[model samples]
Target: MCRTTVANPMMNEPWQRLPALSLKQLQYFVTLAQLRHFTDTASRLAISQPALSSALRQIETVLGVSWSTVPLRRSL
Candidate 1:
C-alpha cells in the first residue's frame, strides 16, 4: 500500500503576525459603515457614541488610517 500526503500551504509559509482586531471591532466597523452615522451605529450596537468612536480610533491605529482621510460617508 502506498500513501501520498499533501503538504499544507500554510505550513510552508512563513509565520506572520496578524492584526489585533476583535470581533466586536469588526462588528462596529460594519455597523458604522452601514448606518453611516456614529450616533445611529452606537444605538444599533447598544453602545455609547464615545465608545464607538474609541473603537473606530483603535481600528484606525491597527490599520494605520485616519478617519479624516477615510471618507466614512457621514460627518463624525
Candidate 2:
C-alpha cells in the first residue's frame, strides 16, 4: 500500500506574508482578556502594569489590531 501526503496550498501563496506573534505576547493577550483588568493581569503575569501595557501595544502593532482602545468592562 502507498500513502500520499498533502501540502498546505495557502503556505505557497505570495500574499500569505503575516507578522509573527511571540508566545509570551499571546499569553499576555489571553491573560488580559480573561482577567479584564490590566493591574490584575500584570500581577498574575508577574509584570508591571506598564510593561504589560507595552507588551500589548507591541502585539497590537504587529497584528495591526487595536484592542486596548476598544471599550470593554475593566477595572483600573
Best by lDDT: 2
Worst 10 residues of 1 by lDDT: 11-20
Q: What are the models' TM-scores?
A: 0.69, 0.69
* TM-score, prediction 1: 0.69
lDDT over C-alpha atoms for residue 1 of model 2: 94
Taking the tens digit of each residue's C-alpha lDDT, what string does model 1 give over 1-76? 9999997777654444456688999899898788877899999999998998899999999978887776767455
Clash counts for the predictions, in order = 0, 0
TM-score of model 2 relative to the true fold?
Answer: 0.69
How far in Å is the alpha carbon of 51 misplaced in model 1?
0.7
Error of 2 at 9 (Å): 1.5
What lDDT score goes with residue 18 in model 1?
A: 54
Report each candidate's C-alpha RMSD, comma-separated, in the order given. 6.8, 7.5
Give lDDT tens digits, candidate 2, residues 20-45: 88899989988988887889999999
